[model samples]
Target: MKKIEVFRKDKWNMIHVEIQGKQLVVREISDQWGEDTHIFLSRPALMDWVQERFSAQRFEGSEEERLSIIEKFKEV
Candidate 1:
């Protein structure tokens, strides 16, 4: 698995995004709880989530560039 990004919610909480084969994995890590929660999504599902996330937002760059970045994740 390759880590794509990590977002720190606070001092003790974090969100991790990773790619394992062709699937995407999201993990919620809590230092205080001493446990992690994970969610796995296939390529299609990942694309669906991405579409939903950007539904109301505008891309900073060309749409082709944004799509290329998404394609890079799939290559990983």
Candidate 2:
């Protein structure tokens, strides 16, 4: 797994995106504050993230969590 290249600096980490790479699995590097991390290991991994973390179930969580995931999904 190679390092992930930034497709969109602000929105890249929020959604699963792969560009300039044939491989689906990607290694990630993050900053100290955990703002720069995105490890896309495979198509399944990305899909799993979407289904679990960014799914409609988010609406069942707190208002803050629901709004946050929705806003992030809007960027992609």
Candidate 3:
């Protein structure tokens, strides 16, 4: 993908965002910490809460295990 040129990261790695016109695109980027990061949430607080909970799990055994965990949160 061509770089979006629509977003930026601050000195503290806090992201600042913008999009051309009204278009929105979801993106994932890797930080210096070597983990994937996500963007473009309509409900950021809820999304962050979900991330916090999911990150606590030690049950990531396989694809089925991961899917089962997600299925438990489908309504959230």
Candidate maximizing lDDT: 1
TM-score of every candidate:
0.42, 0.35, 0.24
Clashing pairs in 2: none
Regions of model 3 farther than 4 Å from truth? 1-59
By TM-score, the best candidate is 1
Q: What is the C-alpha RMSD of each candidate to the true structure, in Å?
A: 6.7, 7.0, 11.6
Residue pairs clashing in model 1 are: none
Off by over 4 Å in 2: 1-16, 20-36, 59-76
What is the lDDT for 56 in model 3?
A: 41
Cα lDDT of model 2 by residue, 1-76, tens digit: 2333322235323323443354443223333344443455455565565556546655345666655654543343
* Candidate 3: tens digits of C-alpha lDDT, residues 34-67: 4334443354553454466446465335656455
lDDT of 1 at 7: 47
- lDDT of candidate 3 at residue 46, scale 0 to 100: 35
Encode model 1's per-residue lDDT on 1-76: one tens digit a residue. 7786444557676555787776668665677776565455576776665566434366455676567555654553
Q: State which candidate, 1 or 2, has the greater TM-score.
A: 1
Q: After superposition, how far is residue 20 of candidate 1 from its true place, in Å?
A: 0.9
